[model samples]
Target: MLVYVVATALAVLFTYISVVYDKTLKDSLQKSRYVYLKPRIDVWQKLTLYVLRVASVLPLVLVAGFRYKVGTDWGNYLRSFRSVTHGKDGHYGEKGYRFIQKFVAFFTSNYIWLFLLCAIIFAGFYFVGIYKMSINPPLSVALIVATSIYFSFLNGMRQGLAQAILFFSLRYVFKRDWKRFLIFVLLASSFHKSSLVFLIVYILYGFKIDIKRIIFYIVIFGMVGLAGGQLVKYVVMKTKYAHYYMSAFADGGFEWLWFFISTAILVVMCCYYENGQKSELKGQFNVLLWMQMISVIFCLISATVPESNRIVWMFNIGQILSLPILISLEKDKRWRLVLLVLILGFYMLATYIAIRGGSHRVLPYRMSFGGE
Candidate 1:
């Protein structure tokens, strides 16, 4: 117990320092030491870049590995895979039996290595996307993205991996690069079909985000809540996601209201920066608007709603990282400090809840594959 608390506190502090370093460290070095991804960057620059990343990432790696090593969910995931393949049902009823049996056979050959490969792939997508599009470079974003407690501990590997691609796909979305964005979305959906929600999200900028629009979304949310169960039932009976409605709708996951609070915060933030807002915040405002809608609608519809929280979190991850970064880029020190507190506070609460969890298996990262 003490171990988890101390480790989480240290992780949070270390992340704060790493982000500060990323902002200021450039002034101390020549241009050669700063650029890492550019092919034409000098050898000295590349080496320095690697050293910097190593310095920041090494500790995060150690802590993250600890979480994974203590991971209980991975074992269950393997069990679900085993059952689904052997003609037995898995934990999630009948949601993904066919899909799991198809590709997850790779797990039998070398599951651990495959997991590692996925972790690395997610890391690459996270760092490049956040850094390239964001004002902060990749190192800082890499440090932040690595500490995804849901990704590392709750065993949200599939969603984690999908969100990584979503992180990258946002660039294409911004560019209206529909082809590339669709390609990325297809890849993400292969990891976890729920990421198909982002399909609606990808083009959300088409609608402006404002108070009137926010009210409109709230109205839509209420309407969906009214009609949720039947709509879900219809879709489930008709489509592959039929199984999705089974556990997800049955779960009655009202706990996912954290997304509602986050949505409220985002609306406030958008209003705060309305005239003075940065472009990224405006973009993220639209993004949050989409996420909030997706989360609320899904929760309303699911019969049980077992995975609704996880899906809400799928949306939360984008809001948490992108909104604060945009706030940081606002050049208002006061807003920066406040945003820092909220980000730190939110993750700390998440870590503590997960650690103290009574039914700890319920963590978002631990995807159960009860393939009915």
Candidate 2:
């Protein structure tokens, strides 16, 4: 637990430095009259950004990659890796992850290679996604880490990978490049079949959400929740998850914390929209609002369908990015600080609850490189 706390704090601190230094470098370049010095400035900027990016994620990658008998599914993933090495068919996870396992096993039977590869992909996409799309990358990184998305990666590697890909693919959604967006969604689903739910994101991309539409969507999805169990069960029975149908049909407890957090983020977004800060990114903001609302709806559905919360994870990227952007949108300095402290405090408290409550068994951190 101390390890996680220290690592996360260091990650956020490095990210803060990276964001601030990047701006400083840009300003320095603009103020310089030396034409020949522009090339040097650009090189320095790139090098610093790259170095800090690696620094921010390095601790997490090392912790996750070297972990042994950690994470609830640690043994399960090990067995799967060994299974792939032995030329047996996959008995767990989706085809894409299994294919990668087989490809790695062809070169070496060591499960460390597979685990390390997954750790890199998970951390890489998470950092790159925020760096590319967020208006305030430091706050974005802090919020995402605090929300437990980063820690959950250790427990659900396949779903974590899928969610990472989907989060990074938000670039295409913001750009309105449907071809690229669809391609990435398909890739994510190949890692975890549950990721197919993200296809609905492209449909929601064009919507301009207002209070009335928000209420309408809530009511409609609320009705879906009333029968979500049977609907989800019927769908699971037709898929590879059929064996888990009984469990899926059982009621999954409501994720009240996430629901409240997302609702708070959505309210902030609505305030930003009402204030009429109509930048070119406003369209993207609208898309994120729709996604955040959908995240809340999935949380509601989880009251009946046990598996629907994974869909909430898919939409979490929206809330993660939206809050930081809203912070950037706030023109008043005092209000901005207040909003930042409130949101950060909320998410950090969530992290505290998760760690103390032992969600995912991510306590008493352990590490090992040797195999069974």
Candidate 3:
């Protein structure tokens, strides 16, 4: 109940702020539009558009509030604490995250209290993304968070506050500030080591893609596959419940293929767009697209070839940035609505199938939100 209240309050506050702030910002855009080739959209019309954008954020809150998936994430959260606290600097040595779990455990070892706290933490992350967007079109941030598997998996992913921090880092990256990106990535690594991979983004986003860099990326991918076996072995032995490694990710074969297809499409979007259009969207798409592409490539080729589906979570790295890029670029309203429905439906179906596959699995405490 407290979770619902907090989520509701944040949603209302974000929507109100976005609507109120846009008048000044849109005036600049309207001036540019007139200076360019187009007639200015009137102030009244722009304000109405602002209201609609603000209004759009509400549904996401409603949906996430209605069916917050609180399963496996909760378990991961407890283990995160155990990894950091119970043993010798174990979290760092383990190569996986155990930091936030330890922090939460400090307050109350009780699972119920821990869950409410986690929900609050994730909601805070969700809003931070919205707050960052208040300077521009804010609906984009809210919509992306609302539709993301990242948001859905907050229970598991919330172990160390990576999503919240990552969103803030993304805000910086969108602004073209490499320094802030470095700072956020460093901070994120303190919580989860896997986040270190995010720092490599400059290698992709920093320089113009030369033929050599492409070759380097290819070589890196191959090395990841070759090194994957040793790395997985190390994490499994060092980390708790490591045997969960043997269970194959259910989305391995065909579902796995779709991931590559998604990456290919985004790359094509980059290539097909004019240099100016690409420049406009690059603010959001460049880092995210490469991150998802690299993440999928790594998961697909790992030579150890054990049942290491955990790597798939890396794909959600693209969701926050990609949604807004697609929304902002898509010119046709009907087509935009179609894509929105398709994206939402795809996640709904995918999530339902995944949860159903694990239906027989039992939780220590079933705080159901009708996801069964």
Candidate 3 — which pairs collide? 73-155, 73-156, 81-101, 81-102
Residue-level lDDT of model 1, residues 1-372, one tens digit each, is: 444344434544544454565555465455545665332445776566555544543433443333432454566655665665566655532243235443555455334433445445565676557555665443234334333433342355566677778778887876778999999988888777877877876767687655556567666865765566566567666876566555434555455435445555555555554543445456655665566556555544333433556566566555534554545655678977776666556655654564457333423322221332
RMSD values, in order shown:
6.4, 2.3, 7.9
Q: What tens-digit string does per-residue lDDT give for candidate 2 at 1-372?
A: 888777778888888888888888777777674655543476766897889888988877887888887777778988988887788976778888988888788899878888888989988888898888888777777766687887778888999899999998888988889899988889999899878888887778665566657868887977877676787678878986676656633545788888888778877777788653476677777778888888888877777776677788878877678887788788899999999899889988977887778777777788777556
Report clash pairs, candidate 2.
Answer: none
TM-score of each: 0.70, 0.92, 0.62
Off by over 4 Å in 1: 1-41, 54-72, 80-110, 136-154, 237-249, 276-285, 292-306, 329-332, 358-372
Instruction: Please report, as a residue range, the 10-residue window in candidate 3 with the lowest summed lDDT.
Output: 359-368
**Local error of candidate 1 at residue 171 (angstroms):** 2.1
What's the number of clashes in each of the models? 23, 0, 4
- Backbone clash total for model 1 is 23
Judge candidate 1 against the unseen true structure and give its global Cα lDDT, from 0 to 1.
0.54
What are the per-residue Cα lDDT tens digits for candidate 3 across 173-268? 667788988887777666556666666665566644432354367568757765675676676767764654555532234335335444544554
- Which candidate do you rate higher for TM-score, 1 or 3? 1
